[model samples]
Target chain A: MILIEGKDITLGYEGQGIISGLSFSVEDGDYLCIVGENGSGKSTFVKTVLGLVEPLKGTISYRGGLKKNEIGYLPQQSGIQRDFPSSVLEVVLSGCLNRRKRLFGYTADEKKKALLELERLGMNRERNASFQELSGGQQQRVLLARALMATEKLIFLDEPVTGLDPKTSSELYEIVDELNRGGITIMMVTHDIHPALNDARTILHLSQGRYFFGSKEEYFRSDLGRMFMKEAGHDHH
Target chain B: MIITEILSYPFLVRALLVGILVSVSASLLGVSLVLRRFSMIGDGLSHVGFGALGVAAFLSLPPMAVTVPVVIAAAVVLLHLSSRRKGGGDSAIALISSSALAIGVIAVSAAGVNTDLNAFLFGSILSVSRSDAVVSLLISAVTLFSYSVFYHQIYATTFDPAFATATGIKTERYTALLSLLTALVIVVGMRILGSLLISSLIIFPSAVAMKLGKSYLSVSLIAAAESLIAFVLGFVSSYVFSLPTGASIVLVHLIIFALSVCLRHSIIVFRSHREMI
Candidate 1:
C-alpha cells in the first residue's frame, strides 16, 4: 500500500518558489530519507507533506487509512524551544492534546499510554524532571516518546540528530531503524546522509538546480548521486 | 475590633470581593502571556484602558462597558499586527501605549477633571460601587470558564506552537482567545487596581510561581493563590494604614517576588547539600 503520494508538488513561501515540480511516493513500512544542502527546500517539503505548509500547486494523498494525527512528527528543536518550562510527562502528555475533547483532563487510558511511552523510551525515572535539564539524547528520546503518544503508524523526523555527538547520533539512528523495522513508515529529513542512506529504501535529494528521487540503489548509480558522492568523498558502496 | 468594624461595611466587602476576582483572573491570563513573551502587552492594554476611561468619563458613559470593548479591540489589533510582522510587536505596543497615555492625560486636562482622573489612574478601591462589583464578577466568571475549557490546548500552544500546528491544532484561535481574555482582565482590573499598576497583578504572581513550581498546572494554581493572598494583604494593609490601594497591592507583589527568588536559591542550595551528604 502506498502510504503517501506527492504529485508534482510545488512549495514555497510568499510567492517565491523553493522547489517546484517535485513528486514522490512512500510505500507502507518504507523508510525514505530526504537529503539536500542548505536552502534546498527539504524542510519546506516536510512541512508541505505534514500539512503545515500548503503546496503551491499539487496534491498529496495518503493511503492505508492514515490520518494526520496517526503520523507522528519530531521537528528540529532550537535552543530556545528546548528550554521551554515543562516536565517530561507534561511535554509527552501534551501530544494527546489534539485527541482531547471538551474541558476534561487526559483520560486514564491516555495517561497510561503516555506513561507506557515513557517507560518504553527508558525515561520513566525522568517523568517529573524538567525537559530543559535533560541531556541532548535524553531530550530527543523524550520528544520521540511524545510523538509516539500522538501516533504509532508513522513518524516524521526533521534533523533528529543535528546537534548530538557521534555516539548519540548513531544511537538515535539505530532506534529509528528499529521503529522502521517494526512496520512504522518513516520520512526523515537530514544532512547526515551516509548512515541515513544506509537504512533508507528511497532517497529524495533536492539540489539548487535539480532534484533526485528514486530507490537507494538507483540514487547511488545515477549521475547526480555519483557527483554528490564524489564531491563529499562518500563511499558509494 | 478595627478589623471587624472594617469588614462590617458593605463597601469594603464589595471592594474585597472585586479585588479577589480581579486578581485571580489577571493571574490566570498572566501565566500564558508571560510565557509567550507578551507580558508587557498587559501594560499596553491598561494604558489603552485609561484612555478609554477618560473618553467615557468625559461623555458621562459607563467606564467599564466602554473600556472593556475598546481594550479588547486593541488586543485584537496588537495580536494581529504582531503575528503578521516579525519584530513588530514591541514597537507597536510601545507606540500604542505611549499614545494612549498621552491621550488620557490630555483628555483629563481638557475635561478639567485632573483631580478625579487620579482615582482612575491609581485606583480608589473604596469607591467600588455595587454595579462595578457586578461587572467585575461577570468578567471573572468568563475568564475562569474560558481558561478551564481551553486549558490543555493553551498548554500545548504555549509550549511549542509549531508542533501544535503540525499536529492539526488550531493555534491561532486559542491565541486569539487568550489575548481577548487578557484584555478583559486588564480592563476589569484597571477599575480597581488602576491603569498604572494593574499589570503587576498579572506579572508578579506568575513570575513568582514559575520560580517556585516546575509544572504548568502547579505553577498556574500557585500563581492564583499568590494573587489572592497578595490582594488580601494589600487591601487590608491599605485600609488600615490609609495608603494608596494600587501602590500597596503592587508593593506586596514586589515583596512576594523578592521572597520567591530567595526561596528558589535556598532550595537549590539545600538540594546540593543533600546530594553531598
Candidate 2:
C-alpha cells in the first residue's frame, strides 16, 4: 500500500522555496534513502513530509488519512539534545505522548510498550541511565527506540548516522533494516552512500532543488551516480 | 532559638508561606528553562517586571495587577521576536533583559515616587503581607495545576517541536503558556526574592539538580527542596545578622551552586583516576 505520496511538492522556510517540483512516494515496507551534499534540501524534504513545514505548492496525501500520531520521526543528532535531563526510559516513553487519552498521565499498557521497545533495541540495561551518559551510537539506538514507541508503519530518519564509528553505523543500519523487514516503511537521509545503497531499495538524489528518484541500481549506473561515487571516494565501499 | 522567634511573628509566617509557594512554581519552570538554555529569561522577565512595578507605582495601581499583565506581554513579545530569527532565543532574552532594566531604572528615577529603592532591588521578607501571600499561593496553584494537566504536551513541545507538531501537539500555544507562567512566577516572586535575586531562585536550584543528574521528577523535588532550604536559612540569617534579605538568599543559592560544581568536578576526577588505575 502507498503510505505517503508527495506530488509536485515545493518546500522551504517562510515561502522562500529551497526545493520545488519534487515528487515521491513510499510503499509499505519500502526503504528509501535520500543522499546529497549539505544544503541539498534533504532535511527540508524530511521536515516538509513530516508536516513541520508547509508545502509551498503541492499536497502530501497519506493512505486512509492516518492520524498525526501514527508517523514516527528521528531527527539528526544535536549535541545539546543529548544532554537533556531525561532518562532513557522517560525519553522513550515520551514518544507515546500523543497516544495517551488523558492530558497528563500514561496508561499501564503505554508504559509496558515503552519498556518493550527499549528491550527490543537491546537498551534495557541503559533504560534508567541519563540520556547524556550514552555513547553516540547508543543515543541513536535510544532515539530509534523512542520512534518505535509510536506506530511502526512509517518512520522518517534524517541523517541517522552522521557521527558514529563504522561498526556502530553498520550496526545501526542493521537495526534499521530489521525494522524495515518488520513492515515499517523507512525514509532515511544519509551522507554515507555505500551502506545505504546496499540496504535501500529506492534512492532519491537531491541537488539544488532538483530530485531524481528511482531504483538504487538505476541511480548507481547513472552519470550523476558515477560523479557522486568518484567525489565521495569509492574506497569506503 | 531563632526558629522560635521567626515562628512567633505573623509577618515571618506570611513570608515563609510565600517563599514555599513561589519556590514550587519557580523550581518547576526552572527545569524547563535550564533544558531550553534560556535560564536567563527568568532574570530578563524579572527586570521587565521591575519596569511594570515602576509603571504601577507611577499610576498608583496595585503593583501585582499591573506587573503581571505587563510581564506576560513582554514574555509574549520575547517569544514572538525570538521565533522570527534563527537561534534567537538567547539573544532575544539578552536584548529584552537589558532594555527592560534600563527602562525600569529610568522610569523609577523620573517618577520620583518616594519609594524605597532598596526594598524593590533587595527584598524585605518583613514586608510580605497576608494579601501578597494569598496571591502567591493562588498563582503557584494555577501554575502547578496547568503544568500537571498539560505535562505531556509541554514535554513533547520542549523536547522536540518538530516531532510534537508532527504528532498534532500545538507547539506555539504551549510555548505561550510557558511564557505566561514564567511571567506570573516572576511577578509573584519579585516581592519575596526581589527583582535582582528572583532569577537566582529560579535558576540555581535547577542547575544544581541537573548537575546531580536526577530524573525530571526528582529534579523538581530536589530543586524545590534546595530553594526552601535556601529561603529558610536566608530568612534566619538575615534576622540574626541584620543583613539584606534578598542578597542573603541569593548568596546562599550561589554557595549551593558552587558546592555542586565542586562536587561534580571531584566525582569526575575520581572516576578518571579509577579508570586509569
Best by lDDT: 1
TM-score of each: 0.96, 0.93
Candidate 2, superposed: residue stretches over 4 Å from native: A234-237, B82-92, B269-277
Interface RMSD list for the candidates: 1.8, 2.2
Model 1 backbone overlap count: 0
Error of 1 at B242 (Å): 1.4
Q: What DockQ does model 2 achieve?
A: 0.55
lDDT of 2 by residue, B111-147 (tens): 6858666777766767888888888889999998998
Candidate 1 CAPRI-style tier: medium
Error of 2 at A72 (Å): 1.3
Give the range where candidate 2 chain A is weakest over 10 consecutive residues by summed lDDT. A76-85
The residue pairs found clashing in candidate 1 are: none
Residue by residue across A1-237, what tens digits does model 1's lDDT show?
998899998878877888788899999988999988989888788888888878998899888888765678888876226546688999999887777864668888989999999997889999999887899999999989988888887889989998899999989888888888988888898888665457999899998857999999999898877877777778556
Candidate 1 stretches with Cα past 4 Å from truth are A79-82, A235-237, B1-3
